[model samples]
Target: MSTSWRDRFEKNFISPEKKLGLDEILEEAHDAYLGWLAASLTAFHSDFNEDQVDQLDRIFQGESRIRSIANDCYNYAINGRFRLAKDAQEQEQMNDDWVCLAILVQSARPGIEEFSLTVRGRPIGVPAKLEQLLFHAQIRALLDFSTVDGFDEESVSVPQFFSQPVPGYLTLKEIALLGQMSERAVRNAAQPAAADRLQTRKEQTQTVVDATEALRWLKGRRGFIATRAD
Candidate 1:
């Protein structure tokens, strides 16, 4: 049988046979979990590429909960108490992360979608794509609880542009996509009279935002991830 995520995690992270210490286990949890998730993706699709794996690593590394829970799971398992209720909760969430990962795989391997559907229950609320989930998670992580105010249809729109290597000189539409804002909102923000106006310039007839200003503007917006360091 293929090794399950639980089994893989225990073998590599818990390392019960080797009797590693808590600090040792926690120190390697992030990278170990990255490999564990990559292995999970490989289980679903053999053709999964490095770029996709790197993207997955980046997404979950930025997500603190993943490493925290992996460390907790390791800590509890070290004491031979692997079946705690909290570990059960963590496992359930990990399953959801795997499902989200399957969505990422779906573009390259469409058949994975059918497999994902088999495992998923009927949607309980508004359905979200993986990008939206990551965006919202970033918001919750970086900002105060009270600052995360409201959501609308646009709020759930994928920040697809944020995934690029560098967000150099974005167009109005690109800025809109990156910020999950409507074109009208992005356009208004670029105007000279607008409050906190973006540093924009006309390239031929169309206006574009400088990457530096773009980052500054996005820092204040909800669901923005600084993929590139300033």
Candidate 2:
């Protein structure tokens, strides 16, 4: 029996190659990551209805597989490898990271976390904690978004929806859209400039909290003492 085109592709392109040395492994991982990112973004776009795709295409300036690859690359580089953990404990930790990222993304908008969590099958409990962790990931995502100088502004800010700290799960875009008069209005008003403002507000809030915590920790140090009232 002969192999079909699909079977040939499965055997050649989809199957994991033999493990290599550390450098080679990283190179291979990077290549694989790029391929996976492209596929995933294509899948995401394909999942949208024609109207939705048309709206996004206008806002984003066109279909952008490169932007998708860049996003995935940034994620992999900052978060390290995406390999499943070796044991149940490690797997749980991985799950925790995913949940946290989902929460952060959801918080920025609203529906994003739920959408990502539902799609990813993350648990509902301890969502707040997960969002905190995702805040860190969102920071990394932000930095990466900033690095791609030529990417469309609207596309760049779209990821900010994942950087917020909101209650429960929601996808980034969904949360952002909830504030609009209606879903159609949101789609019509989609602009990178607006998204940037929302992201800036969230980051500023996080900075204040971090500074406050630092001050509190300094006050609690062994040698620190509060000034007495005159």
Candidate 3:
């Protein structure tokens, strides 16, 4: 008779005969979760060569919540409070869970950032003026929020351009220099939150602006466009 998961837990996972240290298992799982993100990004962005992929993966490892959760799960599993390895297949099941959660994070990142700016934009700290600039009604006309999920509409090779961010955008610091204001002032003014998420991570919230669009935006703010329209 083959041993069951519950049986294996009784025999080895909690016993002195365990095959691997809990800490080692946790580290391995954490690496695998971040590695999954690297793999997905590589598929999404051809311009993100191996070196760039590796660099981003390292950054995510440092910042992501996924790794932290996995570490916690492993520690709990080893203490006999819960049983994950009653059988040979249980470890693989835990890995699948990690992978699924990582993908969910990758998929939802764009939407989350957009929502953050629209709702909780304060903590991220946009210059107060720029904040209003970003959230102005006309801003959506200048900033695009959609993503390409597939090429079913395409009849040829996918446009490599999709792998990168749309051009004509600048960071807050750049905008500050162009506006001849202190960066702090720019952040203080940066408000209203725009949709700034990306499927390929081309830009982050409060980190991108369109100088030309901003000029147009400022005109409206100053009543030039309003006056012209009136």
Candidate achieving the largest lDDT: 1
For residues 42-103, could you state the per-residue lDDT of candidate 1 as single tens digits? 67785455577678768766336544544433332222122212344554554454344323
> Model 1 — which ten-residue stretch has the worst lDDT?
118-127
Ranking by TM-score: 1, 3, 2
- For candidate 1, the C-alpha RMSD (Å) to the true structure equals 18.4
**lDDT ranking, high to low:** 1, 3, 2
RMSD of each: 18.4, 21.9, 24.3
Residue 187's lDDT in candidate 1 = 81
* Candidate 2 TM-score, C-alpha based: 0.20
Q: Which stretches of candidate 1 lie over 4 Å from their true place?
A: 1-103, 106-109, 112-116, 120-128, 131-167, 204-206, 222-230
Measured on C-alpha atoms, candidate 2 has an lDDT of 0.31
Each prediction's whole-model lDDT (CA) = 0.42, 0.31, 0.35
> What are the runs in model 3 whose C-alpha is more than 4 Å off?
1-18, 54-64, 82-230
The TM-scores of all predictions, comma-separated, are 0.34, 0.20, 0.25
Estimate, for each residue in 11-87, the C-alpha lDDT of model 3 and write its tens digit. 32221112234455444444444444444554566323456645776775443555454443333322212222333
Instruction: Please give the distance, in angstroms, between residue 185's alpha carbon in candidate 2 and its true position after superposition.
Output: 45
lDDT of 1 at 209: 74
